[model samples]
Target chain A: MRQLIDLFVSFFKIGLFTFGGGYAMLPMLQREIVEKHKWATEDDVLDYYAIGQCTPGIIAVNTATFVGVKLAGALGGAVSTVAVVSPSLIIITIISTILRNFAEYAVVQHAFAGIRVAVAALVVVSVAKLFKKGVKDVLGYVIFAVSLLLVFFLDVSPIWVVLAAIAIGVGKALKAGKGGEQA
Target chain B: MIYLCLCWEFFKTGLFSIGGGLATLPFLSEMGSKFGWFTQEELANMLAVSESTPGPIGINMATYVGNTVGGVLGGVLATFALVLPSYLVILLVAKVMERFQNNRFVQSSMTTLRPASVGMVGAAILGVLQSVLVNMDAVRAMAWSQMLSWPNLVLFAILLALYAKFNKLHPVVILAIGAVVGIVCKL
Candidate 1:
């Protein structure tokens, strides 16, 4: 009960306040999970983030579930998931209802324009962090550069990039097999 | 039927956007153009709000996009779509956790995907930058004089410096700081 309420309140706060997306959500997650609630240690949260990245679901939600389940159980997972999404549900409902008029206000537009730059800046900063942490070797760096070029210059779908990497990896091994060798 | 379309769109998002939600920026931009379901500004607004909100960025974006198209139902459909692939993949992996945990194919595939994910994220960044920064004739005109204007550069510098210096700061602080910077720049 208290645990569930806490989950809801924490996630509602997260849903209500986080801006600029996943990377931007980190500091908040750190504060709530590590500082406020002590649900996860900084190291544990960092590990959760890494696993969050490799996993398919949304990073924040997955992190919530991971923490919730770790703390409680299946019920905790559901409770936290609801908690995280609850604010979004409420906020979006309001936005949907009043959206027709929200777009026309000059003050609103100006605020938004400012927010855009801020969002971009946050993302750029977060990407630099991810790169520093994840890009371990020369091959990793080269791969990063290539993906950037493909997505930016060519507007290629990232799905294809993953597919191509899988092929290159598997194909190289197959070729090595023909030559009677293994790594 | 609508749910299926929602699933397909998000399945595409999940299957690719390997680096995460930011990696989907370009594709979402294109979707804005294709479906006319969301305007460019609206999508930016969504990105901003979604950033501040709880849940996943991809899920947040999907909810925004879906709601714009089909209300609460649409939002639910879109969220489901986005999670469908991950749920299936994770479930399968969970079921088969022991047999292939150390398989070379799996190891190498992950290695390869890491770089690939970075490229996808980089591309996403480029696409978003182009969309946001280079609006219309000014971009095409290539006016070098204003390109590196001191004030714009200063704002960029302050923004970057602040982020690097305080990466742990709440995003709202960053936004508030940017607004102040914008007002200062204008004056």
Candidate 2:
């Protein structure tokens, strides 16, 4: 019982401080989950990060679940996931309700205009980073190009694109067998 | 019924939005138009607002949309639905922890998934840029000269330059600067 509360409070703090999305939360995660609590090691956190990246849902949520499961059990996972997102639920509910009322003001509109531009700029930066990190080899480039064309030009669902990639990945893996890295 | 609908929508989003929070953007945009929950312009506004606040962007969006559609209970339910898949999948992985990491099957899928996810993000941001930076109504009216939003573009450029120069600056600070500049320049 005490462990559960500790998990809740620790993850709540992590969630509260996580500004600018999931990656920005990494340092706080390292502090709380690794250094402070010692619930998981550095390698364990990194492994969770890797698994989180490939798995469905938000990486932060997945990572929190992984740690929670490690600490207690399925119940811990449930508690931690809820704890991590509680801040978002509460804070955004307040902000959105307020914004819905204030959004009609000309000043608010102008402010959002600037904010939108800034958001786009930041997304562009992320795209650059992702492209650099992910598109390394010929197969990777091909996968990226195909995914881009399908999602952009055809307006296909991203889920289908991801599924197709998985099939292609598995096929490549089967073909290679245990003969070292394919890429 | 609306709660169930919200649950299903966000459940699908959670199950498929691989990579991270921003990956949910494409699904949310589709949901917005399909359900008539929000407009593209409204989505862009929400994205800006979500990024500026604390916690995960995807969860923030789910809570916001659910609240708008159903209520506070709806918000909680939607977030739970969005998290359900991750919980189950992580649990399964944790059970098979020893073999999961070194497994070639997982490795290969992850390699391809990485680039594919990035491509999806690239596509998703294109839609956002259209809504935020381009004057689509002007383009639809065939006014070529008025297709771009110049003030927004100028602000975007300045922010991008600032980010490049001071890469360590916090996002909240950058957004605050944007709000201030908007008021001062009347953008």
Model 1 global lDDT (CA atoms, 0 to 1):
0.66
TM-score of model 1 vs. true structure: 0.75
lDDT by residue for model 1 (A44-163), tens: 777666555666656666566666666676666667666666666666656655765676876656666666666667767867766776578887788888877876666566566777
Candidate that would win on lDDT: 2
Stretches > 4 Å off in candidate 1:
A1-52, A60-87, A95-100, A172-183, B1-4, B39-41, B141-153, B181-187
Local accuracy of candidate 1 as per-residue lDDT tens digits, B1-187? 7666666776677555555666566567656765677776677667777767555567677778878777788876766566555545544443344444445666566676767765666565554444455544554688755443354345556777888898678876876766666555541
Best by TM-score: 2
| Model 1 residue A1 CA deviation in Å | 14
TM-score versus the correct structure, for each prediction: 0.75, 0.94
DockQ of 1: 0.38
